[model samples]
Target: MNRSVPMNKAEDISRTWLEDFAQLLTKTENVEEGVTKTFLPDGWLRDLLIFTWDNRSLNGLRKIACYLQENLPRSVISNIELDHHSELAPKYLPLNDTLKCVCSGFKFSTTVANGHGFFRLVEEGPGCWKAATVFIMADSLKGHEELGYELGVYGGHTLSWTDVQAERRKSVEVDPYVLIIGGGQTGLNIGARFRQMKIPALIIEQNNRIGDNWRKRYPTLTLHTPRSYSPMLYQPFPKNWPLYSPRDKIADWLEQYASSQDLTAWTNARAEPIPVYDSKAKRWSVTIIHDGTSIELHPVHIVVATGMLGIPRVPSPTDQNIFKGVVFHASKYEGGKLFSGKRAIIVGAGNTSADICQDLVFHGASSVTMIQRSSTCIVASSTTRDDLLRGWPEGGSVDIADLKAAAIPFLYLKKVLTEHAEEAIAKEKELHDMLRKGGLNVSFGTGGSGCFPLVFEKAGNYWLDVGCAELIGSGRVKVKHGVEIAKFIEDSVIFTDGTSLKADLVVFATGYHTMHDGLKTLFGAEIMDQTGPIWGVDEEGEARGCYRPSGHPGLWFGAGDFYYSRFYSKQLALIIKAIQIGLV
Candidate 1:
């Protein structure tokens, strides 16, 4: 018997062994041929790879297999050793006298490359072992470079690069294969994926500039999630960027992403009427108002990336004509300075409600009160970063985290999250006690599924307490829980409990309508009803109406935060591409 190898030596041996395995995979007729049954045993990778590929359809898998075969190294690059610092490292099983290793690395060539590989191996007997599973990245073998000779010096060329760009910009009437509505994070992400797949796509934004959606938010707003959890596809934020990026910084990043990725977005353009889909031709004829001029486009597909919460849902309070105070939705609340020395009443108790209340307090509002229509799931921001997002730590690969997340079915994920939430709540008992004692309404969320599930299912039921919970606990921000607005009087709002409070400004943080409701004007009630509800877990445990087909032909919905968009954009692009190529 031999003693377990040192960590460094174990890593080296694993790397060399995996490289050999990679070479063996290249020589096989098919990448999946004889790899799993012969080398790897039944395990996580086996289940995930086979399930994903099989579910994607054999035709789709064949296309992917061809791509892998074309770019996988016929032999290992001798000069360049595999990246050993990958998250997967060999572990010593002393009790079993075995070494288990799971590893991944990338191999690049001049024109094409193998992007990533996931491998699992265990010591079968002494010096000999077999791979349990191996998953490799498929690369489309194509060169990505601009064709030119000193701008205008080439043969048959008369225009400079700038002139060419201007000409291209002028020709906006041309037909595109895919038309994406909303140039926000989701839109830009899918657009970038389409660009990589060589699929022609155009994004139409209602705002004059890209990222105005983020820019229009409150002045003190910053991303609640970490930078690693919220990155655009292909391009991540610079290393020096704040962990929680400010709103404007993110806005600027979106603008730069769209430009750098060369995504064709028509800003200040909006779809005028409901798009008419031709079932027979599998195309969408959309009329968009661009700079006050209507342009008709017949695109093969129309992706509604207008976000999960597209329309601000402002409840029309009765007796509105009597109230004299300023009234607006949370979306219209840009800053607190405007409400200085004024009593503010924010309706609803969610993340936005909490943030707005904190902002009003900071900006010297005379009195701020949060009306809690329902209990909110409250977790500390630190808890979210350390526990909920432990999978996506700083410096970890976002793609890897995404892949790992996708591997787990949402049903099982919900169970896992529920258990995690229970443990998390117990761990932070002091915080929960403080919140409860301070008269703040808190819950562990629906079925104790915590933040992620709540976001996916309800979209506005949870709040990751940054500082507002403390403010509420300390009475800096008053909490009026378990109540509903009865009606508005001349200068105050009366609660259902017969309590009246004077308010100079009323902010409704009641949240937005569903994506389906938001599309009623453009898609019409009939078409929208056919499309089904926007966000929620479907029977398949996937996000309803996203990445998968909507009920209507040639219509799709892409909505989620940065991670969700980045992770699922490939599936959306592949589906679109498959349809275009007649595979699906």
Candidate 2:
């Protein structure tokens, strides 16, 4: 069908809904041209209602009339297509002397002399009028208020209020406890590396056990990317760390790594909205309520390592009351033990689906059907590596030029050359040779390559290949020709193709959504509006990820959106180092 046909319909719907929304917004006490509407807290309430229905429809009109007495914007009314709907008239109630009226939960004094701020409303009619409250402050009082506000009028006049709190600089010993929120490689590495840095860290897992997550993954699961590039924060996997390690081994290794480092991680320590407060002692107060006991602890910094894959959102169950059977998110799967005597249907096309499919077959399942939304760009792990290392049974090195000559087609030679230079100058011959064999070329010099200086070249393509071949070749994990799980019926699941398949279990391995949830509040609306893309660099002309429109000192963020180096741990190390040296 024509996709553009829905475009006009959607816009018309948005215009109608927003018009009603604006009328509802007029109930607030704080009034100005559009100030009341702008202050309506940014949340699902605003997001969902803004573009939901067309004001022209009868149902839409009823919804608008019922929810009208709230704070909404004036632009909404101008855009709304109100033909001859007499019910779409303005509604208002004046402040009476006998009793004070609480419009939109804002209390106004019955006597005019008692009220601090008075507002006006922009109404269309008796039933359609939208009250716009303009503040009536005496000239003298306005001057006094101005003393505490800084004004900047560029795009428009914006008053930034200065915090009136006392700047209490306290002297206290540096707190040492660290709370880690994820169990992935980043979490393990960050904690382990912190240990090396002489900092104590506590890892909290949302799951039941430490490595049980990786243990229950699909059997065909193997690391798609190479190991050398994706080194944990502290140590590299075993010397013979499979170009791709299996699912169970990755988890087992993490557990062992924690044990080896003596990390303070509590399994099942799912930090569910633990209250974190600033203390009078000038440290952070973390109230961890575990096992019915409230543990008050202070940590210098909270390192959130909940990587990209923690939140798995499934398609909304079309009919919540109906469909039964097993519906588990990828994060909760133990194995196919329950799928022993039933046909299983898996959703999503990523690595998790491949792993789950293989596991189901081995557990004596009747049949396994995989459903995917898009064709994945799958490749062998061996292809994404330092070709010579695998080529030579007993690993040795090749000259940079030799590698460039051999892997002529691959355009990554310039990167390899830069790494070679760093290795050669560091006087680390073994590392130098490793760079050479890993398809890199370099010359010893202080003056290096271009903007992407050859120096961090090897670091760029950190994990190219590892265990992808084993997963794709594994017979049990079949690549099905379908996408989008439309709905789940009682005994079968429907696909986007209008076809249904009998199923027992549905696993959604459809990767993680970008984490912008925390940013909406932490940075506020102005900053969020200026934010480019949440996870990566936006191709259009916008600010880079995590970069402030104008840099704010001491107020810095990492991990959320910025793409830095793997030795980014080293970068963090350097930052901490500078802080220690007072050179920051």
Best by TM-score: 1
* lDDT of model 1 at position 504: 93
- TM for candidate 1 is 0.79
Please give, for residues 261-297, the per-residue lDDT of candidate 1 as tens digits. 7778999999977788888887888898999998899
User: Which candidate ranks first by lDDT, i.e. highest?
Assistant: 1
Weakest 10 consecutive residues of candidate 2 by summed lDDT: 164-173
Query: What TM-score, over all chains together, does every model reach?
Result: 0.79, 0.48
For model 1 the local lDDT of residue 275 reads: 85
How many collisions per candidate?
4, 35
Q: lDDT for model 1, please.
A: 0.72
Alpha-carbon error at 166 in model 2, in Å? Answer: 38
Q: Report the lDDT of model 2 for residue 175.
A: 34
Question: What tens digits encode model 2's per-residue C-alpha lDDT throughout 1-584?
Answer: 11121222423433333354444444333333333332222101111112211101111222233333242332132222322222112212333233111112111121111111222232233222232221111111111111222233432534322211111001111234455656666666666555555545566665666776667665556665455444454455667878656777887887887776555666665544433335353345655545545555576555555543335666775652466767877766777887798877776654466567667777887777666554432222344344323432222222211221221111222334454544334543433344334322323322322212211221121222133223334434444564577777888777777877777777766655554445444344554454444333322111133212213222222342011223233334333333333433
